[model samples]
Target: MSEVASEVIREMKREFKVVGKSVPRRDGIGHVTGKTVYVDDISFPGMLHLKMVRSPIHHGIIRNVDFSEAEKVPGFVRVLTHRDVPKNIYTILCLIGVGPDEEPVLAVDRVLYKGEPIAAIVAETEEAAMEAVSRVKLDLEELPAVFDVEEALKPDAPILKPWGTNYFIYEGHHCRRVRFGDVEKGFAQADYIIEEVYNTSPIEHAPTETTACVAKPEPDGRYTVYTNTQALFFTMDNTALILQVPFSKLHFVGGTVGGGFGGKVDVITEPIATLAAMKTGRPVKFKYTREEEMRVSSTRSAWRMYFKDGVMKDGRIIARKVISYADSGAYNRHTPYAVTKHAANIAGPYTIPNVYIDAYCVYTNRQPASAMRGFGVTPASFAVECQMDKIAETIGMDPWEIRFINAYRNGDMRPHQKVVEDATLIEVMKAAAELVGHKLPEHLLKMHSWDREKA
Candidate 1:
């Protein structure tokens, strides 16, 4: 361990018993011994399996749906369509007062993306449910679809949202906007202008265990839900609102999730399964098959970022302008919030006098994108670091020297108007150089995060 870190740990150990001590994990034994209980491990008597009939095309108007053959299946219990849902339209962030409730519990009239659920089939067995779902027929009229973020924003782009725009509306603005100083003046005064575009594809979580839930109707006039959801109260509350039932009537049980990585936070599979149990007075299990988990479940949104930086010959950045677009796919699951975060972070950690950023949460004919590990910030960091490297190369300066010169200090102000209080970029970089066996120049070695005047 580094001397500084070791000293800090020793100081903390004097005040706290657990600090600097090895601790045993409470759940490690259960996990290693295979005794840990997961949502799919629990089953009840008279349980029914639920499967969905999804849209085959990316964008289409539903012409007709025929379930006659599906009803003939031997163990077919019943089917739930949009009509069966108590409240059809929902936005996952509605609890936080975010939205126009753009997503449907079950798609009606049209399907915006492939794998969008149109109907759900319940049967005595999983195989029977799968068969019934396959037997159901759908007549859809295909429509033009847009996948590219830039293409979706063009004037000639096919409209996707009901609000007649391909992007999420942020407070009367088309995109989240951040401005601090005069970027044009700074750019004109700079010696060189560096511009680059960075693009990232959508990424799937693909947890070891797929999303699953079991809702059972209790004899005491309440419902019990066994779920793998990362958010228990959030899911229960949203499920209650979707089912139009009192919150007191639902009990959500969640623990031992195989893996989430921000994937299982969305409130899917619980409400519909609970409703099925309510209608039939029996337990209903809704589990996403591997195919459904991979193809239909929410993934990290794809991002396209355009970065333009103005720098002097001495390795100091004077201005930065970033235009970022996040492809939120068909619905507003969690991408709106993610875009807001992206807008705040795309400026990066460096302190520039003039900064301007516009980040848009765009919609396209693809599977809806939601959260992943560092959903919004990770992409921005990737683009920002790459842009930093490009700037260093163009200015004929060492990358570390450039970073050390522009690194934000403790009292620096960010583009978002927040004062940086505890920044340690210089110190951390120095420690990293030491650990990696790289010798920084004397001037760079003397730089500290507390005071930038030394640099």
Candidate 2:
């Protein structure tokens, strides 16, 4: 190994005590022994089970919702509709200044997508809740639904939002945009222009323990919510806002999660369950069935990315213009923020002189998309790496050489204008090549992240 490589290893070892070492997982034993208590495992005495009555049609105006049959069901306690929610309109990102409260706690007036919750049926038993939910009568006027991201943007497209646009407005712009240098000039100077479109489907988190919460009304008029939410504080605050109560009136108990994978971050169950508990003066437990978990929960947004790259014969990428559309589905969950992150990263780690990105968080008549593992950046990385391979094929150069030529070094400016610091892509790539038995030439091997002169 070179001296620099040895020094890097020494530095890593010095900075990270756990690096290259195995430590026993703190929760491993409890998990294996079935001693771990998930939110669904806990129940309160005289607790009411909550089941959602959802929309069957993808797009529709709810002409009427009759819960008389549901109320007639044995063990049915009460049905909570949008009217019952103190402040029904809520957006999970409201805490971060991201919305005008787009999502309804229980959908009002109309249902935007199939499986959108219209009413919460609380009953003495889970079976009773399910039966009551099934018995609720809905009269809906079906509307033409647009599922494609591009189709939703057309002038004739069914406008999903009240502001009269299918896409999120970014400070008066139609999309989140980033411009570094003059992309047109770079393309004019290039030998080749490689253009391709990439598409991705929404992915469900499908955690072993589905989205669940148990809300109990305290004797002191406060509410205690036991949930599997990954964002405990966020859920509490949002729930308080939805309930129109002081933040101090809510106590969120969490920390044990079967699996989140970014799905549990959305404030879905806590507010409504707590409201149900408050109205009935009894604890309310809301849990998604396996099918409900798969069908109704928020997912990683589907993406359509168009990449047009200006490349040199020697394999340096001079400019990249990326137009990306993220299907945020019926509501804005975390996708508005995700699109901003996507705009910053869609160009990847390469240091192109000129880069342009326009990322849109679009509304469609599908289930709302939210956070998953690396919601904004993972899809971009996939597209970028694939585009890199395409560029290598077009220029007749080694993929490794192409990457090393364009890899951003420390002190480089990202397209978002953030100063790159502590970048390790080049070094990590070198080590990865060796581990995979791919022999890189000396020129590529000598490249380091710290100094551009070495390249």
Candidate 3:
């Protein structure tokens, strides 16, 4: 190996000491034996339970909200509307560093999606609070709704967030272009060109523990919240910002998380519980039903991709282009970063000379998409890999061989013009192919069959 390669390997092995070591999990026994205290186990003296009232229409103007009947409920404490929430808009995935126009603590004047929170109620009991939430009267003037990104981009479509256009956030002014060689010359030298469109559906996080949080106000004028959150720091930041309180005055504790899978990264039930506690000056607990959890929370974005590739007679790749539209439903959340990552990774693990991509993060009337396991790379890979197989078939080559020949190597520039240094992608691909016995099949046949006659 070269000196540089040797040094890189040494450093990698040095960093691998703790990479795959099997240590006893911190919460193994507590988690399996149900001895751990989760957010749902929290209860405080003189505490109230909270419930939110959401919009039933996909898009509408809020005409009126009446809390008189809710106040008459058996043990109702208070009914909160947008008027009660502070006038501040927040981005749920502000860590990606986008503007504040993406999301808000509560729906201010209009309801863009079917289950957006419009009002909330607190009572001595969860059932009573839910009853009061159901009793609250809301008058909405329904507006025409657009559920698709293409429809939302139309000139005549209704604006989901009137202050902001349907476009959530552009990646950067000119972040979508990547080129290595003369694309016109490369395509002129190509023997064949192929194009395909692919679609991927949105999926849920479906964490074992649904949304739940408990907020307790201390006698010293400080608040502590227990929640099922992935990052305690981000949740603390969101709570402090939303409540207009100092970070020092807020204390956030994450319990043994049942499962996150990138879903528990947002301020959902915690903010609602905090609002109830702050308003009532007492501890408050809020938990979401499975249906409510599905309706109000974010999920993975649906993708529609158009991919094109130019290949030589010997299966060398020349050029590529990808155009994608992502559904950033109801809120911007992580759509900006997600779309940018998709744009950057559109070429997959290939050494394409010319690459161009345009991705739209358009708003629609559904749940806003947040981070998932792959965090926007999976959809791009799905399209590109399928296209790679198609290109291989056209040029009489195996998919694995084509990918191996075009895979990134040391000093190779990626689709976004980033230089690869001492990469192990080729080695990993070789190991994977060896382990999986890579081959193309000529016919579909059952690989395993049960033999009842032997018994």
Candidate 1 TM-score over all chains jointly: 0.97
TM-score versus the correct structure, for each prediction:
0.97, 0.97, 0.89
**Candidate structures ordered by lDDT, highest first:** 2, 1, 3
TM-score of 2: 0.97
Model 2, range 1-455, lDDT digits (tens) per residue?
Answer: 68998999998888886887688999999999999889999998999999999999999999999999999999999999999999999888989998877899998999999999999999999999999989999999999999999999999999999888999999899999999999999999999999999999999999999999999999999989999999999999999999999999989999999899999999999999999999999999999999989998999999999999999998889999999999999999999999999999999999999999999999999999999999989999999999999999998998888999999999999999999999999989988998999999988877789988632
- Tens-place lDDT per residue, model 3, 1-455, is 35998899878877886664576888888878888888887788898998888899998888888888889999998876666666347776665567655565667778888988887788999989989988888899999999877788888988776554777544444223445566667667778888899988878898878888889998898888888888788888877777678889888888568788878877777776887888899999888888887777778888888877789876778888777888878887777788888878888876787776778777888888878878678898989889989999989987766876676666668877787666665567655655788643422111111111111
lDDT of each: 0.93, 0.94, 0.77
Residue runs of model 1 more than 4 Å from their true location after superposition: 1-8
Steric collisions counted per model: 0, 0, 0
Report lDDT (Cα) of residue 101, candidate 2. 79
lDDT of 1 by residue, 1-455 (tens): 46998999888898986766778989999899999999899899999999999999999999999999999999999999999999989998999889989999899999999999999899999999999999999999999999988999999998988899999999999999999899999999999999999999999999999999999998899999999998899999999999999999999999779999988999889989998998888999999999999999999999999999999999889999999999999999899999999988898889999999999999999999999999999999999999889999998999999999999998889999999988989989998998999999998887788877742
> Which is better, 2 or 3, measured by TM-score?
2
Q: Model 2: runs farther than 4 Å from truth? A: 1-20
lDDT of 1 at 3: 100
